[model samples]
Target: MKKRKTLLLPLARQFTVILILFTLCTVCITIYSTFGYSRLQTSFLNNSLESYSAQLAKSTREAYESYENICYSIAYSQVVQNYLMSENRGKSYENYRQLENQLSNTALLNPYIIDIAVYGQDSTFASLCGSASNYEEFSRSLSDSRFPYRSAGVATVNRTLCHVLAMPIYSLGTGESRYLGILFLAIDVNNLLGNSLKSDENDYDPRILFTDASGQLIYGEPQLYDALCREEDRSDVFQIQETSDNPVTYAVTGYSIPGIEHTLYVLIDKSQITRQVARISGRQLLVMCAITFLALLFLFLLYRPLIRSLKQLTDFMNTISSGDRRAMKEGAVIHQGLIGSKEISEISTAFNDMLIETEKLNHTIFDTYTRMYELENNNRKTEIAFLRSQINPHFLYNTLTMICGLAAEGMDDKIISVTGALSRIFRYSIKGSDMVTLEEEMSIVRSYLMIQKERFEDRFTVRYEFSEDSHDCLIPKMVIQPLVENAIVHGLEKSLEPGELLIGAGRNPEHGYLAIWIFDTGVGMPESRLTELRESIHRSVYNKTGDASADLEDLNSQNHESIGILNVNSRMVLYYGTDYTLLIDSEEGVGTNIQIRVPYRLKSDTNARAAQNTNSKGENHVPGNCD
Candidate 1:
């Protein structure tokens, strides 16, 4: 019962952790979606306001240009010029009637024209189309200005607000022209902007305004105009927050009409955007909640059977741990009927087999103990033999010959350096622990490469690449050197052209291992040899009882061509396990790559036996790579 409770505690903790992670992910996705959607909606609204403001400004400029053209035509008319040039009283009334008729006909050109009038320099005046009551006042305000055309500002004419324009007429008769009079054209402001100001179906309730360069309002609400003028350094698009006086927040955008010194402003209420975002956020939250609930339900269903199977297995283990022989015999048979997944069923079968083995061990405890002692002693002998195989006599003879050649050529420094590097290799190989820091191992590899460099001359080059952080990681001694040696002897030495050899070590934190690799660009092996080499390296030594001795003898009998690599593989398996062995890959005429993976351990982890056992059985094995 205690074991069952112990097992259940971890499962409960795991379920809680999974639930929390799922909820956190759901919340994060919800927040991101809501924020992104709000930003998208705001961007869309700003673009719409900008487009709307541009359209209104364009229409206003076109209308003003049309009205100015009419004023220009009337100012240069022959009949009007003739009337302004005439001084006869008898023809004055006749000229006046013709001028009035002409003005009436010109007013028909635009439906929004309220009135057209002419004020003469002699204080004479004539009107048509409407009561032109303000024409004299409008023309008198700009009497001193020399400009041919100008706006006379907004005024109440015929009890309606009108946009008035004033143009100075000149006598068309001659050389040094004389100022004849002023022509005033009054246009209905409401009718001019009516079509442009209508709200769209989206119900944004956009307010449109027209103002001069100096911020003088020509059209739109006076309150909004006053608020807009208070803002400093306004850009093409901006927002207005709700205040005490202005209770509505607005998104404001505008455009300046070129050559007219006028700007058009479009203001949209922000409440619409806020409501849209709220609706979308609410829907997202609902979906997130639904998904979270369904995910939690699935987690519960998936883990329920696993939890039950574990509880049953724990009970059986507890019965065995109690050391009651009769209870153990009964529990073993009962657990064979235990059920769950295929993996769980296999585990139950293995547990039963272990129990049956335990019963057999009770009958032959003496024999089992004797064999275990023999295996340990033989394992040590095998390791010693593997170490001896790493020191090649031919390699030493070659290095001595190269030193003699350098000495005869009077290169004393080259001979001394080569001798020193060769001595370091022998000293490091002879006196060291079976496990050493990656830095120490790499030092030996560099020493070995230096000697090889002297031996091969310019036939090959060596490159060392190692991560600084992984320099302190612990690995089996002499494991990487043999791989490097194999890369040179079997791979690079066979090539006619100069070759390159790369040796590197780094931490593979994702897989919790240390990765050491040797790559050579040289004549590579065929597919058949590559496959054969991989099978030989991966082959287990102790597949059954008393097989360790046979495997060691077989390794001794293998050819010298693969003896170095096989020795390295054998040591790694004895120390770490098959799971953390060597990986070899080769392609014909391309290259060969060899990699070694071992559990990442530091000097602080001094218990090598515990580490070996844990790596061999406790952890799942990950496949190797040559990259």
Candidate 2:
């Protein structure tokens, strides 16, 4: 018998290769079409700019010619020539009136002509239609000109920007053409060029500019003229790429007027072309996506049987890998009875068997992990409780010793006060919850400070600063009192002068954390001892093991003076992690500042508990008040 060939796998490989090639070809075609379309659009824009610039140049030339003809007619008219050639031109009213009439009639040819004037050779002059304040200057400029028949450039006339046109007048009826005077016409630039440059289309904003032979702006925006002059190539048409200051790109074209020394430029915004290309490219991309989708659909139909079986297996494996406990417990397996190929049937059978074995192993591992997590959590809680217990005894021993000293002196009133305050401290510390509101915490701190005041007498005073908003923020119990006790014993007791103990509680606006600080103005420790104490506290926080109670015992044996601060640091780290640990700063002569920072949290039943605690105590809680 002849060996049979399997065509399914090879056919699938070929289909993949075809899809990849199709994708590459589609990308190449899109890129080529976009590039070609951009170039075509740019060319079309350049041509449009060129045609528009020519139209502007034509309109500007016509305006110039019309104004020049008016000057020529006024300069050569018999009435104006007679006025300039007369012996006494300014003195004769009839001559002035006739001369003014001729100039006025000639200016009527163009409404843009704002002023007309004629100067005589003997310092005599006549004006019509506008001011003649600068007629003498105009005449002198013309007479001193290298070319008397040319324009005198632009000037301001009657507070309006105008183009000055000068034409020389000679004595009529004379054998020799003798110089008589000059005729001046002040033409309004805005009225002349404004209509010609206004664009009718709204797609692109076009800017028209006119510059003289020396590149100075004759009319229009000086900025556009300056940009045109900066171009290295003086081509008739070019593009100004987008700039930082001016985000709009422009296609610029220049045209020289037929009868003047001025060049006109038309700048059309090129963003319109970019928008057009983007729209075209978008359409092309849509069509390509549709074609690709149809092709993929056809391929999927051709290989539906093979793909369907593989997809089922893939989905089941994904469910198991994603740790879906419900699916694993239900023992969902792929039934291979529907599979047509022997190889796929074998794969389905092996996968089903492997899933059964994996489910069993998964349960065993999960049970072990759960047990480990529970044991670790319980150990951490026990360690924190043991740390809290350590603080109560250390504090009570000091208070009891002070009470004994007071009894020896026979101070009955002071002894009563100390015992009462100690009673309040004991009640507050022996509460069930490890967390309490900051208001309750500060209340206990006040009782502790009151007892210290009785023992020290005039040796130290207490000051309290607390924000009202931080009264209800939750913090670990017995955290602040230990630091306060430490400061009194180690810091204030050694000082001879009267010292001040500052206890403050507030919310840190920067970190949104509750802050409690104890500061003492007494003798401080040296840097060496401060470093050693800080290292010991941090080591206790990091070296926690399964047995935190044992760790606390080891910490207590190392340092006597630092036990209170170390106990506070370790408890905070255990309850709130290392981020809420205590920060200690001290100087040899300045004293110590121990600050505790904890996240701002409030217990859900804080109000109810607070009311209950207050009712039982028969008094309202007062924070930071010592009498």
Candidate 3:
């Protein structure tokens, strides 16, 4: 009776339900089956193709690299390096040939190399075993190479064409001017490629050919249409594309050989396997059709329920796509179907994470630009300050000269020493415009010490000792003088008894820097003052002002008495960075010490060299040794 009611229902409604269900189910099943089957086959074949391609590529790459290695080994031979260094022009042709012969015999792996060409800088080409017939042709051909080594030619032997590769040999001299020669290797590319691609199976064979950038064949001369031959347009194709399908049905890969400036390709064919994958089964198709009809009948019985479930899925997708992230965060529009899924939830999470990262990236970029702008502004101001500071020393030097002249006329015994020291100090101030020798800075320090001794006579003594090797090391001018002056005025001037100020300069073997120390036996500083000085030396302008209770606060916030120390420290850091200079150690009652470490070698700087001559005037006199 139920079957009869169903049959009596309107045919269109019943037919539509069954047909719709059948089409949906069969379409889903067939699409899944087809894609799954095709992907598996394609993946398997691609993997095989790639694996075969990789192995062949590795073999060919190793062969070419071996050839390159051998050529480089010959090129960098001590004999060659020594010959180039000795400036042996084209005269050492026989000696170069003997070297080439020895290298050819030594390379057991690639013994077929017939000749080597050494191209000298004068466009003359010389070879160890090549013939005289094509020497002119070879030389003319080589004019393009500029054969910085021996000769300008095709670098041939016996007038027979050969596979060739060459590398530019360089002299071990410093600077951009030391190139000496070009080393050429005449090789059998066919033999190299053949031996490298030797297959294990009898049925499989591989062939390789070498060509120039223009796609003209350069090697494998005897066989034109062999297993490997030049294709009509293959040469042009390889130049443009890195990878392409080989019309021969073989998997292929390309690599650029060093020194050759051309592409080498490797190939493997899979025509048979591809044909097998194309074969389909007729019986299976019939069985699939039967299954489709049965599914249609079952779906008509549950049409209403299916529509309701689809609506639920639609609503879930819409909720996730909404721009309101907060709504999604609350986990609204949950899927409660028997076939539950969490894919929608995961997508939402990933989207939110992406938004968060984008915001952070934007903020970081903005902050970086802002900080860069502020630093540029500060740099400009510092330049202005430095220019202003330069003006006063000239006037100071003139005043000292007049004083020294007056004193000299009166036969003051100490007048000459003071005048000389003061004069040197002024000249160095101008001379150290950019950089000065270690010898120059020491001169300034000696002069400053002299002035102090005259002002505070018999109160203190200073001594200096420096390594002979480190005398040539360059350092900033007037760097040491200011520190010495500080020590005398702040430490020794106040003392009654004679105090000792010992200055020592030497190279530090461990750090590769010059370590200079100024030690004084005078009134030392208290812990509070020492701490304040350290803070001022390291404090940045950005943190100059902050809450009073800030941790690591500036203790010298009252008066910038340590400004000189801070300035020197900052300048040292700005130039060589904090790793180099302005090290201070002090103790109450005992003494104070300052060490300035700088790189021990003058880094060939143009400005330093230009100022070297102008800066030699005042380095000889003792600063405070005047009687």
Candidate 4:
């Protein structure tokens, strides 16, 4: 139950945060749509109408100026001038006909011009434009009676409003000129204004109106213009008006033509644009709500399974702490509790891998420490066995028993000498230290040899050569005694003649090693036996240390003279790291010579008894290459 609460707490917090942010975004969008969309709709309509009105004003003004240019061109022509200057109005009919033809040609080429005509009150040009009453009255008031062609904004002509251009003719040649009649071009104003705007038969389309300087409505419905803009707003370029019939507001845009005093009005009903924006806002709000619903649904559905996976992981961790290693290995480290997060899955996988590796490492460390402890124990036992081998229990019993018999026989000197040697041997072997001065080790060697001589009944002769400088050096305790024991058990006891045993220690001048040699003139070892012994020593040093207990068991099994030599070799290798070993020379009928060389270790014993400077030489022990 606690695990469920722990997992759901984070998910609940996450969902709460997301819901708040999503709601805030929806609110902001709703507020923006409510007020901002309506403002944007009004702004767009105003800008569009303003552009359209500017276009209409520019195009309508150009049409008026074009008609004025046509009238001016005809009035300056040679045909009209000649007709005005001619005296007889009837006989000079060709000039009048020529002038009439020019006016007709101009009217035919211009579609907007209703007619182009010339009137000469004094001359014979035809008055084809019904009448020109205003042109006649204006001509009589002129000093030269010549009117320049110009735009007269808007006036009724032939019962229809038309734009008029009046051009007066003169008797124009190179000489002095007199005024002729006026050439008046009447343009249909209604036609131009009607064509300037797009047809607004559809009520939704924009309605436009053009008004002259005197406030005469030229185009579009007057009702729409008045409803959209007030008299004051019409003077402004852009304005808005609210209507009474409907709550729809209208946009009004007006532009003035450059040369003429006429303004173009463009009106648009803003409610149509409002309805479009409202529909779009409604759809957007619906979609947002739907998306919010789906998001909530997805998060709610996620609760159960994600919490289940988290609970599983929590249980797995608890089991791990309780030491259930098998369960940890079999459980999935990553699953759907990831809840769309790749990083959490990666962390789970890494932790699982770490635990697996840690377990392996723990086992490896245990095995390593176990082997080290066994090796240390085996080294202890080997040293113990070596000390005891030098003073065997049975040998001590027999030696004491022999001394008693000899004392009964009244051999005081032999009993005392043997007992002293036995005492020194035991004292040397019982000391706890493994290191001893070389001279002390030699003393133990002499003691052991004396005991052997008394037991052998004068069957072997002994020889010794010693160097005083090398004798003070330190060596492992009882290292040399094992080699001497092997020589006696295998050499002197087996020879038919009185055998010789040579024991010597010296500095090897060539190798600078402290060389100790043991030679015996007993029956020499066969080459195969010598090889076998050498192989045994070498194999023990290399192969046996991995399992010291196995070596001990093997030693217990073997009954041979090689064990002591093998033991010495193992101890040497263990101490000196494989630098010291035995070198043996032998002949089958002669004797065996064994030499041991060790790195010259200095005497650590500062105040020890001096070695006996004596040699009982039966055979010379050579100090150089004995091979």
TM-score winner = 2
lDDT of all the models against the reference? 0.77, 0.76, 0.59, 0.69
Ranking by TM-score: 2, 1, 4, 3
Error of 4 at 347 (Å): 6.4
Judged by whole-model lDDT over C-alpha atoms, candidate 1 comes out at 0.77
RMSD in Å for all candidates: 28.3, 31.4, 47.6, 18.9
For candidate 4, the 10 contiguous residues with the lowest summed lDDT are 609-618
Q: What TM-score against the true fold does each predicted structure earn?
A: 0.41, 0.47, 0.35, 0.40
**Tens digit per residue, CA lDDT, model 3, 1-627:** 565544465444666876877688787787677667766766776665556656655665576567677767777776666655554556465566666666556444565566666665554455666743434444446545434322122234545455666667766546655556666667655555667535564234433455555545655332422334445444422221223753444444555655445556655444544553444322344566777767765664444344444455455457657755554444434343454335544554565566567557767988998997787556634532452233234335644665666576784656777777777776666543455687777777777776666666688877878888777777765567667766775677555667999988898889788988888888879999888777666563334332322312242353344544555554565567557658889887788998888887764554576577557645655688531
Poorly placed runs, candidate 2 (over 4 Å): 1-304, 317-326, 330-358, 391-398, 405-411, 604-627
Q: Once superposed on the true structure, which residue ranges of model 3 sit more than 4 Å away at CA?
A: 1-409, 540-560, 603-627
Q: How far is candidate 3 from the true structure (C-alpha RMSD, Å)?
A: 47.6
Clashing residue pairs for model 1: none
For residues 321-355, write the lDDT of model 4, one tens digit per residue: 89777876765464664454454566568778888
Tell me the lDDT of model 1 at 240.
54
Q: How many backbone clashes does candidate 1 have?
A: 0
- What is the Å distance of residue 506 in model 3 from its true position? 2.9
Higher-ranked by lDDT: 1 or 3: 1
Return the lDDT, model 1, position 77.
94
- Against the true structure, candidate 3 reaches a TM-score of 0.35
Name the top lDDT candidate: 1
Candidate 4 off by > 4 Å:
1-375, 390-409, 453-469, 496-500, 505-515, 542-550, 573-585, 597-627
